[model samples]
Target: MDIISIIAPMILVFFGYTIGSTRIITGGNEALVERLGKYNRKLEPGLNFIVPLVEKIAIEKTTREQILDIAPQPAITKDNISVEVDAVIYWRVFDWVKAYYEVEDVEDAIGNLVITTLRSAIGRQELDETYSSRSEINKTLLEELDKATDDWGVKVLRVEVQEIKLPDSIMESLEKERAAESEKQAAIFKAEGEKQASISRAEGTVQAIEMIAQALKGQSNSKEVLKYLVAQRFVDANQKLGESNNTKIIFMNPKDVSEGVGELLEEDTHISDERIGNGSN
Candidate 1:
C-alpha cells in the first residue's frame, strides 16, 4: 500500500476508537455494560465511558414508569361463564442488572405472568363477584406480580381492569331482571299509597261523624241527628250508584225521608214552645 493509504486507515481507526469509547445516557434512562461478554458495570444517567472493544452497552432503557396493555383474554368464572377481560399494568425497573439479566423480554414475561394470575383469580370467583370485586382483583394482581417479578428487578405499581365483557344472553337476562324488579317496586308503592289514603279517609269520616254527634247531643236529640245522618248517607249512595255505568235503576220515596225529618223538627218546635209557656207562667 502507498503511504497516503496507510495514513488514512490509521486516522479512521483512531477516530472510531474515540467515538466508541464515549457513552452518553440521558435523563430517565440506564445502561448495562458487559466486558468480554460478561457482566461488568452499570451506567447511570449523564456521562459514561466504556473500554471500546473490551466493553459494550448491553442494554439501555428508560427507568421511568411504563404501561403494558394486556389484550382481552378469555377467563372462565367459578360459575362457568366466559368473560373477556383486558387490563393495563404500570411498572418500573428498579434494578437494571437483574432486569436485563434475569429475564429475556421482561415486559413480555411480566405480561404473561399477569395474565396467568388474572385467570387464576377470576377462576376463584363467580361472575357476579367479578363485577363487584374489581378493586380486589386489581389488588390481588399487583401483589402477585410484585412477588413473582422480583427476580426480574421490576416493581408493579398498579394493575387496572380496562374492560369486562359479558355474553349477550347474560346481558339480556340482567335487563329482564331489572325491569321485573322495577315493576314489583312500583306495585308495592301503589298498594302502600292506596292503603294510606283509605286510612286517612276513614279517619276523617269518623272525626266528622263524632263532632256532629257531639253538637247534636248538646243542642237537640242525638237519636234524631243519627237518623238524619243515616238517611243522608243512603241518598248519597243512591246518587253515586246512578252515576256509575252498572245501570241498575232504583226507586226511592223522597217523601219518606222528608216525613221523618219533619216530625223531628215539629218535636223540637213543640219543646221550645212548652219551655216559653213555662217561663211565662
Candidate 2:
C-alpha cells in the first residue's frame, strides 16, 4: 500500500512531463516560448521539451511562403490616362520574432504597400510606357516592398502585375492614331519615289539634248544633214496629224525654198572660183 501511494505521485508527474514534451511536424512551425510568463528561447521544429504549467507558447508563426492578391485600384498615368491595375505578391517570413510582433497583419500591410507603390509607378509614366515597362515596375515594387517589410520579417520574392485595364475610347483613339501615322509614312515614301523618277527622266532628257546639240554642231555645214532633219520633222508632224483623224493640207513657202537653193548655188560658185585661181597660178 505504501509503494502504491508513492508511485501515484511519480506517475502523475511522468504523465504531466509527457504532455509538456511535443514533436512538431516537419512541415510545420512555431514561435517564441515563455516559461513562467517570461521570454524564453524560440521553439523550433522536431522534439521540444517544456516545464508543465510553467512554460507556454506566446506567438506561433508559419515560415512558409504565402500568396497575397491585391484588389484592383485606380491609377492615373502621366498622360492623364486613368486605369485599373491588380497584382499578386509572393512573400515568406524571414524572421519569426519580428513577424510575430512587429506587424499587426503582414499580409494586409504588404497589400497596402504594393498598392501605393504601383500607383506611384504608374503615375510617373505614360500609358504606353506603363504597359511596356511592367517588368521594370515589378522589380522596383519588389525592392520597395522588401525594404518596407524588413522590420516585419517579411521577404518579398516577386511581384506580378496581373491586369491593366484601359478605357475603350482610349484604345480606339490609339489605334486610329497608329493607322494615320502609317498612312502618312506610306504617302511620304510614294512621293519620294515619284520625285526620284522625275529627276531620272529630267537627267535623261538633258543628256539626249546635249548629244543632239553636239551632232548638229559637227554637221553645221552639211546640207544633207539639214535635209534629213527636215524630213524627220515632216514625218513626225504627218504621223501626229494622221492619229488625230484630221486631213489638213500643208503648203511650203516658195520664197524660203528659193532662198535655200540660192545659198547652195553661191557656195558652189565660190568653190569653183577658188579652183580656177589655183590652176591659173
Candidate 3:
C-alpha cells in the first residue's frame, strides 16, 4: 500500500507538470513566454512547450490586422474655424516583442499619436482645404502614423479621414453664397441671351431692308411700290401696338407716311441717276 501511494503520486505529478507546461496557441495568435519575469521566447501558433513554474505566458496577442476608429473630435483649422474630425486606421503587429516591450500600450499609444497628428495636420490647413484635400490629409496621416508606430512594431497599413463636419451656421452661409453665385451666373446668362436676341433682330431688319432695295432697283414704278410698302409697315406697326396689353394705340395718318416715302424715293432716284451718268462718261 505504501509503494502504490508513492507511484500514484509520482504519476499525478508528471501529469500535472505535462499539463502545465503544454500550451496550445491557436492559429493567427502568438504568445510571449517570460522566464523568471523576463521575456524569454515567442510561442507561435499550434502546440508549444515551456518550462513549468519557471516560465510564464506573459501576453498572448493575435497577429491579424486590426481597425482603430477615432471618434469625432474638435479641431481648429488654419483659418481658425472650429470643426469636428474623425478617422479610421488599419494596422497590424509585425514584431510582437517590440510591440509588447517598446510601448506600454501599443493601441492606446497609436490612437493618441493619431489624434495629435490629425490635429496638427488640420491646424496647417484651412477649412475649405480640409474638405477638398481629404486624400492629402489621409496620406499625411498614414505616413506619420507608419513612421511613428515603427518602433512599436505596429504597421499602419492605411488611414482614412471619415468625416469633417462644419457648424450649421457655416454650412448655411456656404449654401447661401453658392445660391447667390448661381443666381448671378443665371442673370449674366439671361442678359447675354437678350443681348444676342437684340443683335439678331437688328441683323434681320437690315437684311430685309437690303432685300427690298435690291428688288426695287430696276422697277420703273419703284417709288409707288416704296410708298405702298411704307404704308403697309405703318399699318403693321399699328396692329402690333394694338395687340399689346399696355401699349397706347395712336393712329397715324396714311398721307403723312406717303409723303415721307415720296421724299426718300426722290432722293434715292437722284443719287442713282448721278451714278449712272458718271459711269456712262
TM per prediction: 0.67, 0.59, 0.76
Stretches > 4 Å off in candidate 2 = 23-25, 36-38, 172-281
Model 1, residue 235: what's the lDDT?
76
Off by over 4 Å in 3: 131-133, 210-265, 276-281
Model 3 lDDT per residue over 66-108, tens place: 9999999899999999999999999999899999999899999
Full-model lDDT for every candidate: 0.84, 0.76, 0.88
What TM-score does candidate 2 get on C-alpha atoms? 0.59
Q: What would the per-residue lDDT of candidate 2 be over residues 220-274, giving only the tens digit for each residue?
A: 4544554444445446544654654324546565446435643554566568678
Per-model clash counts, in order, read 0, 0, 0
Give the winner by lDDT.
3
From the highest lDDT down, the ranking of the candidates is 3, 1, 2
Candidate 1 vs candidate 2, TM-score winner:
1
- For model 2, what is the alpha-carbon lDDT of residue 217? 42
